[model samples]
Target: MRSSLLRVGVVAGASALVLATMPASLVSASPVTDPPAVDCQSVLAAPTLDAAFDAAAEAADVPSDLLRAVSYMQSRWEGHDGRVSNDGGYGMFNLKSTTTAVPDGAGKGSTDRSPRRTASQLERAAELTGIPASTVRSDDRANVCAAAALTASYAPDLNASTQPQRWTAAIARFGSADTFERQVLTTLREGRARTTSGGETVTLDGDPTVDVAPPSASDPETDCPPDLGCEWIPAGYEKLVPSDPDSTGNYGNHDKADRTGPGGPKLKYIVIHDTETAYDPTIGLVTDPGYLAWNYTIRSSDGHIANHLDPKDVGWHAGNWYVNAHSIGIEHEGWAGSAGWFTEAMYEQSAKLVRHLAHEHDIPLDRAHIIGHDQVPGVTSGATRNVHWDPGPYWDWEHYFDLVQAPIGQSAKNTSSVKAGDVVEVRGGYADNVNTITGCQQASPGSGDCVPGQGTNFVLAYQSPSLEAPLANDPGWKPNGAAGTTYASDISARIQSGHKLVVAEVRDEWLGVWWAGSLVWVHNPATRPVVLRTTAKTVTTTSTTAAPIFGRAYPEPEAYAPYEIPVQSIAPLEYTLGAGQTYAVSDDDVVTDYYYAQSFDGSIPDDRTDVKGELRYYQLWYAHKQVFVKADDVTLLDPGKRAVVPTRLPKITGEAKVGSALTVSNGRWSREVTDFRYTWLVGGRPVAGATGYTFTPRPADAGERVVAVVSVDDPALHPMLAPSLPTAKIQR
Candidate 1:
């Protein structure tokens, strides 16, 4: 959000205001000389935008660094052709004249106003340089030249000793915003650099005479919570060489491009992730020029934040490129199934950061926009079944939303039972909601290593309302009566919280939801239900008995050209939604297509290879998973009010450090507990007489894993035993 008050170059008529302000002593007495007549075609031939800008500046007698800084200020050096900003700006220069005129005001109705003229910036540039507006809009070289010409018009006294501050007003005019001028000056004085995805190196050294001004009106301070020691460690974008000599691999995990151009992708979501690794290691990974990156990472220990990539750039973290293109990724430091819960400090800071981003970007404050890595859609049919599920079930979506000022339970008071045509939210409370998920250490190679501290924010689906019944069937994974396991590899048997479900059948405590084309039941008793009743539009099959489901929402046959592969556009999955089943439809109208580009190939005009289909699909909230259905075969129902699941998880604390005592804290719970018992284990074997509040490890425990198990007993609730995540090999 750069302020627009520092405009010093923009003026009425064909010339800029700075031209008249030039000191006579600073002006060259010799006749003004133009470098050379290089057309847009020649400029486009350069290897990188840096080269093009350098050449343009040389020809136009403008400082190459100034031109580069101006372009960076305008579009981050992304070449956006023919796309218009919200304020009618276009191209890399973001010239306002090419598109509709948008008022330049800091806020809605203020006395201050920018100079409004009869001509647009594009028209003025064309008028001053005799270059066609179409050429300027269509060619990268032409755009650079136009930008260079503008900079040349504001040329001030020049020498090796010239201070960058002297050109601040001119730079501000180039960006048409004072805030932008500060950004340019800072970049110039501090040095601007980045390695393009195409493997080109670009850098501009800070001017020796230029010093960045102190924080002021144009360069405001970042408003962050005072307690958190926030730091801005820029991610390395330097071109890297492969460690293996024979490999041609390189890394600088982001693309420099605008997302809203005609061929450019539109951003729509913000994804949350958990770094399976710890805080320091995670920071190291992100800073490695050769590794992937996320927009932000929140330290679990102290709720510290490190912002690496700019929100405008695309980072390579999400497995799906479309999601990567459309979303900002935030990584939290914690294990998905560890006994130690996410700290409150981290949650507060994360909520504040997300709230600011959502408000600034106009992102919807709902599950649909603010999502986990598990919810990102697969790019193709084959990719859907294996999409990652991270920032896993343990993440407390309920608490997170509340901190963001959008609690999921805000509508829970208005509804009660899970009914047909109504939406239900799964509410497997984190921490204390002791859920039984089989297949942990049992799946390991030799001796399995598993612990009770393994927690998830999901509830297993059952075939009947009673817990005695077997789990529901998954047509894709366990079609032959295989039970769903808690192993990370198995996603069939559970329904995570925060997901919306369409109620198909409600029998007392049991509620059936349409899951992966089948009716799956989950225990939702009136006394301790895992789900909350909420008003939502439900979609049921229109066919006599069932409707086929699909891994993707591709277009109809007629949408594709005859030369292309036909079946690739519309392949139905092996599963189907039964006629009697009802499921919540998050969005009934969605285009069926894929943003097929896996990575940026460094095309100048952004050649995004896309696969668009003509068919329409409805997004269904199936149990804990998200799937697609044919919009044609489903009938949509409208319901009025809604309810949400409650959150309740007991907190556990203490590190599993070797030779050190371990402790567990019972978290805030909805039910009252009468007593607590503790048991310590060494290498998964229960220790004799080891039951205590704390136990110091001995030499015998060396090289063996250690853990603490706490059992809580309550009068009205079932007895629950929660284990701590095992420690590394115990030290002597």
Candidate 2:
């Protein structure tokens, strides 16, 4: 996991109206009298992405490091074929109103639909670079050139040849927030590199000695990481019914509580969400009484964080109240359906903030504790399908976790060892694991196409082990027994990366996992191994009949009788746990309780109280969402302790290429043991009659990482079966 760096900005300008839409400080520098300096032809003809930035910088007379760092922070130097951010900015440079002013939301309860609109910086970029906006939008080179020209025009204080650190105000002029500027310069100081979507490696060498003034700020009453430089724009917290002087049932935006303070609910999870709208308008809507609220809003362009509801309060963001009651919600400025809308700057900043929150609240840095809003289950059978699936398939959870200092599979200790009934994490590598990702809105039609892998966060499970079988089904996602679709929202067949489940049956490379109360098969090829062996605690149902699954772990009826409130039913969801089926545990012996908080005014009896029940529920990582099973009807199994331990693992060596001989150092155990075995794998499936000490790759194995499961016999130890780390991808 990458260390959560300090809260980790281009102002398109040389425009007028006195920096109307852009932040006043970020881009308020007087425009320079520079000529049309962008050498569009040179930028286009550059041999590499690194050379493209260098060419654009040389043409505009700006530091190449500045251009590269700003680009890195914005799009991770990715063009993505020139996609626009949710805030309507474009390209690797984020050359637009990246620092578009976020509404302060002071008069939060106001029902204002219209947010102040300003002239787009894209127009200013066009004017400064003397290029058509269409060309700037589609061509990566043109976008970089325009960014250089526009940013150079903003820095009238800095000539064509200014020190990298001296460009802070100019970077700030690109966007107003000091955090935005500092982050850009921080990228320069620390440097960064990334492989573009078009498959070109770009690097900006870091000079840790590069110095700049510390960021300035005015963050009052804000609960945020110091590096983030967040602004407190509190979501409305007033009575919705203004006519009723002391209305108990009316409230706007969020509920007030003493969470994360002296006395409050145990903060367990952090739910990630994406705003369907742009950043500024999201603030406008969240402040409105009718619209729901979340804790923070992260901007796509600059990574500026806007703190709304305090950690001490509850935001009505997640549809399930139980989840909201125990979780903190963070919203990013992007649409779930829009591919490449989430920026690297936003991911870095969000990671820092999340790392801070997780550390502060003592929450575990795992998928169970850090979840997407898409994983939030509905409160009942009817409501399951209605839950929002934001921060969708393209969220890059593996990268996000890497930034969060968890790095998904870094938690694996006994990974090279496993047996039946053990738990495993779905881990198809992001850059290579091509997935069939569809969208409810038809936003991504690239499903089932494997040319340039569109990496996703889940693995599709099939009703049978073969590729010809239909995808597995989910009762809550679809009740008609229809198979799962490729829709981003329909997570029926997708076993999200890092999700842990019990192994039901293993037939060669196909693993039959207990998913949604059924045994579904997931292909775990030895090559490009999709699942990581993990020693996680799992639980099985003790009930003779199928155990009922609940979305919420609410208090029993008797627990709420004393208060003037109706009981929150512990409704069983359509999905259930079969008697023999087991699932990985999120938490054991979770308190079965409910919070009674439905009043702005303290008119109701026992308001703002947590109702505790004698009954406890075990939280399980079941299917796409978590489910609560009664602890009394569940038996917690210590799978981790029972796993077969490997003292000295077998090894493999030789050329890992097509038709090249790859040798495995196996078959060295005592000959007395007759149960010992070895197997060679291609694309994770076993090669027929190829269980020898050495194997040769075929033409079909090219570009695929072939592997060998070297099982050694030990008469003293238990049966052990595991695969070696995948060998290098086969070469031609």
Q: When superposed on Cα atoms, how far off is each prediction in RMSD? A: 24.3, 13.6
Error of 2 at 397 (Å): 1.1
Q: Looking at model 1, how many pairs of residues clash?
A: 15
For candidate 1, the TM-score is: 0.51
TM-score on alpha carbons, each prediction = 0.51, 0.77
The numbered model that scores best in TM-score is 2
Best by lDDT: 2
lDDT by residue (tens digit), candidate 2, 322-390: 899888999998777665557777898899999999999888898987999988888988788888877
Candidate 2 local Cα displacement, residue 545, angstroms: 1.4
List runs of model 1 lying over 4 Å from the truth. 1-230, 234-252, 260-264, 377-385, 414-416, 438-456, 477-481, 544-574, 589-601, 604-606, 609-614, 640-732
Q: What Cα-based lDDT does every candidate model obtain?
A: 0.58, 0.71
Tell me the lDDT of model 1 at 354.
85
